[model samples]
Target chain A: MAGKPGRKFQLNEKQLGYAMVAPALVLILLVVIWPIMLSGWNSLFDYRLNDPTKSERIMTESLNLEEYADNRYLVEQGVNELSEAYPEGEETFNETWTVVQNHHEELVAEDAMASSYQEVNSMLNDYEPITDDNLRIQSIDGSWGSDFEAAMDEQIEAVTAVQQQADGDTAVEIGYLAAQLENLQGSVLSSNFVGLQNYADYLLDGRTWTALTNTTFFTIVSVGAELIIGLGVALLINRTFKGRGIVRASVLVPWAIPTAVAAMMWSYLFDGQSGVVAHYMAAVGLISDPGALLTTASGSMFSIIFADVWKTTPYMALLLLAGLQTIPNTQYEAAEVDGAGRVQKFFFVTLPLLKSAILVALLFRTLDAFRVFDLIYVLTGGGPANATESISVFAYKALFEQQNFGAGSALSVIVFVCVAIISFIFVKLLGSDLFPERAKK
Target chain B: MLKNQAGIRFYIFLAIFVFLVMFPFIWIFLTSLKPQNELTSFAWFTSNATLESYASAITTRPLFRYMLNSFVVSGLTTVLSLLIASFTAYAVTRLPIRGKTLILGLVLASSMFPPIAILSPIFNFVTDTGLRNSYIGLVIPYITISLPLAIWILATFFQKIPWELEESAKLDGATPFQTYRQIILPLATPGIFTTAILVFVAAWNEYLFALAINTADAWRTIPVGISFYQSEYTVPWGDISAATVIVTIPIVILVLIFQRRIVSGLTSGSVKE
Candidate 1:
């Protein structure tokens, strides 16, 4: 096959290279990049999944046909019933009833929306669910939406006046009609595109600022503690000693445990009432009271940072240990021969040689710490007044709990920018090239 | 050379270090074995021990099912990441690529992107596409997020293999695929093993995506499932600890066995320079 030129139909090496890498590249793009772009798009709108009116971003005015069709019929029937029950306000009721009917007809009579309304009405009549997005929500003209909203408001005011003139059941019926008209008015979905207003709001939002500050505080403290403690552990383990393997393996146990499980364990340990660790801390006078670790804001933050350090310091140690192994013993021996004591040797030989490793470890840990979520989420639930809420926790609350996608995505984007800045500082400012060896060439 | 006090001091420091590292695991184990009645007590140690919590942890909820879910998702993630990453790593390191450093840097940078930053969009995607609660939903992010680390590990290992072996295989008329399968793979087993362990641990421990993407109980992994104990009637400390122990065992075992390889894997990717 090799002897004959053009006999084999194999892809050339470069083509093969591209072919091999294409799946991974495409996967990263779709899974990582595409969702981020979607969030960016979402951040531009006032989309809230909980509210039917703003469930989706509406560039053109939209009508919630399901709510509209149901409410329109109710408004008309209720107005007629009220007018008959109270003949004294019949003139006012009748006039208001006609106006609502006219707006309703105008809304259903639109050239762009008439057919869709008919389909939706029939679907609602048949008691079938409108699962199709287009059928459930139909876009109407901008002028029609505003005109209908204005007409409904006038009708509501007229009905409210009529209700005041009536008594008991008649007044209640008129009020019901007015409520239905108000709801129908709400069914008109105007454009929710707030044009980066969510970002502006989040920037000024106190909770956002608090979350950012909490995240920064947590990252700095936790990463600093992890680096110092991890380096010490790494130095200790790097020495040739008996049972070092056992000690090393023991260190990894905490790192090996799932972070959420670790968080859960700490939550138990820091429990105010029955926590053993809390009991011991209180007994030892380190803490004034049992169960105070997770209740107070500062205490909860300290507990979380403590837990994070406990969980990740071993990982830092392992990374630093690798860097330590690379620093040859001859350098230390040379330092010793130069009349350098242990402290002097460590400061001169060990610290200088371990700079790159420390930077790498700090980079990884700092970024990981700044975006901390599962720990705070599981441990504190961002609780006792959201004292421990990291930006990620806040974003989760906005997106899921509040069902505010626009606000949530704005928060998510803020986190992305902060993380990008941290990464930029580490790589560009600190001169910690990710591929440090490659940069030399 | 009477440095006997220094030796004693070193052992004392090591003992304290070992205690700090092992105490949580021991405490959790002890808590898991304690009876339900003892849970409300602030005792340093329980007088009686029982496996009742482990029984409840397994029987009261879908602990095994959650474990199965974690296993499937993590296992699939490990395999797919290893496969995709191995190919990309091989191409980047062994092939005639012009900008290898640029590609490596990009891969490394991708890893540092905040996972939460992409959560909102991923949530929208999974819901809209009806991929919510499926294994593939979690696995998709897991694969991409873990790819950079896996690729870096594999590439560093691939770069160390002498080119002479591949050239000889080519001269013997073996295709690239055959060379990779027969020659390179056998030599790169250690790197592949370490990367697999790392990816599996990551996927198994992943909480945010699992919690966000999988709404159904059937699809929830161990970490997300154990969290349900938090929201239950009262905090089931005993059962939660048991579940934690269940989830932690496999990873602990892997770490115990492959400690050195994991250290190398973590460092070689970052601190090699």
Candidate 2:
């Protein structure tokens, strides 16, 4: 609207707003929303990098042409030697070899499979590896895939029967051919996609429930502790005091430490043998034994909650402190003049006034604590028996350590749903004004 | 007069509080300085102190390289997030954009989306695009996640900034870009500084993405680097403590120097809401 009155070539305010919002929205889409949507989509498949057949998210059955070609050559040589060794079983060997050869030719006769077959065969002949998954992997009909597999199985069975009936070198060579034929059959890939099956499997998985419970327990315990202690610290620091700045900064040292590094520090302090905290706690009768902290399930949970509380209390306090600062001195003064004690004034004035800050801080800390990863990871590595593994850690193990992307992404989606629910409860039920525009206006 | 009687008690409580908070740092420092043989010994004070752990913390690994990597990744994340979030915050706060509240809410909600939920897809994308183990790879997601905080903090600050100055500048024939560049940015320095510090700290401290994306030692940051100290069968407590101290020094310095800004930055949005 202002463009008409503005200098030439200068955009209007709305246009400028769009321009400003572009990069961040684009970034958020690409780096945040896009990735989440991708994970959600990926969770529908049975994808795992460790298993070659299920390494990719497949919508259609495909052939691994390089593998097919390599195994085909081996099958041919193996069957030929079997025929030479057992002249009596030559008919059986020829029949098995012809069936495999015919199937290979039939598979290549398909338009999509043909080009991939040629390319993969040429690459193999040149002793070059297939780098492109698409080029090396060709699509096939679902029925054809099942039929081919059944056909290969029959050939393998026939060859095995012949080997059983024969003697000496004949038996051994026929056995070798049968094994090679089976390996060739193994190269045929089907659609890896099993929509929503990963989610269903994990939903029924005990480990998933254990991780969810662990995450819930960690979030509840740690955030609850942080809130109470943080409120106390906030009140303490809010008062006029000597060296207040130093105290404030010192308290933040735990929060300011990189989470992984803080976990490292705590792991040291919780170290059974050399840890001073463990020693002191034992001496103080806080623990029955010094060495039992990190090794036991409940104890490891307590240790992580303790470490998380120590690291995050300052953050909670900082938020609460700002909230505390906003409350006018006159409110407290009025309460005091009315014969209200400290306890009365706090409950009637401070807590009611500080609700928004408490809600916001609790929401943030709960979400963060629920997603606890680096701290638990560096400290316990999800422990002696995975008693302390959070959902994030569980997802990490599934995705990276075990290369089960489908299950990992499913776990990831579960975390997202939990976080979304927590946020909804906070924003809608508790009436926390996360965006204060309407209230402010 | 009544407040004065509680003064001694308050100081005593404060001393206890400070001690509780500072003990871990003090112990780690002491442990870092202690020799290997003295580590398991049950002495409150070490009579012998050596810098041998610190020496190995640097010598036995490319600790300096990790520091540089952290610096590059965090520094870039800070600058980029600050630059972009400031514009977005300014637009959301000052412009006549419809659904400003919705935009703010979306940003806040995105920040709360669990990092693990997003990590798998990000890992796959980074792996596919061949951005793995590179600063850009790490910086991209760092910027995305940190943007919400930066935007929230900056919006709060920008809302407080008087718009009259911008109006006068526009009347004086300054283009929108010039007014923003010359006047708005300079005035928003404190807010920018606060956002920068928060973003930098978050980026520097991030572990999951750094751990997932970078397999190479060269691309690893301090947190990821310190985690590697666990690889050896014998847990080298001394070297780990030393590395912990080293990894924490920069953040400690930042907190010390900008304590007020950092506190205000952290507390502003939550308090304002």
Most lDDT-accurate candidate: 2
Candidate 1, B50: how far from true, in Å? Answer: 2.0
Q: What is the lDDT of candidate 1?
A: 0.83
For every prediction, compared with the true complex, DockQ reads: 0.54, 0.62
> Which lDDT tens digits does candidate 2 get at residues A40-116?
98898889988977887777877777788899988888777767777878898899888887787777677767777
Give the per-residue lDDT digits (tens) of candidate 1, residues A1-441.
223264477755666677778887787888777888888889999999898778888777888888888997787687677667888877876787677667768776766577888888899889998878778778786588888888878878877887787788767877788888889898888889898999999998899999999999999999999989888877776766788678778877788777898999988888888777888899999888986798889889999999999999888988888888888888987887899988898889988988877887888889889989999999998977989999999999999889999999999999999998889888884563556443334
Candidate 1's C-alpha runs over 4 A off are: A1-4, A63-142, A152-187, A429-432, A436-441, B1-6, B40-45
Would you list the clashing residue pairs of candidate 1? A272-A291
Docking verdict class for candidate 2: medium
> First chain of model 1: TM-score?
0.81
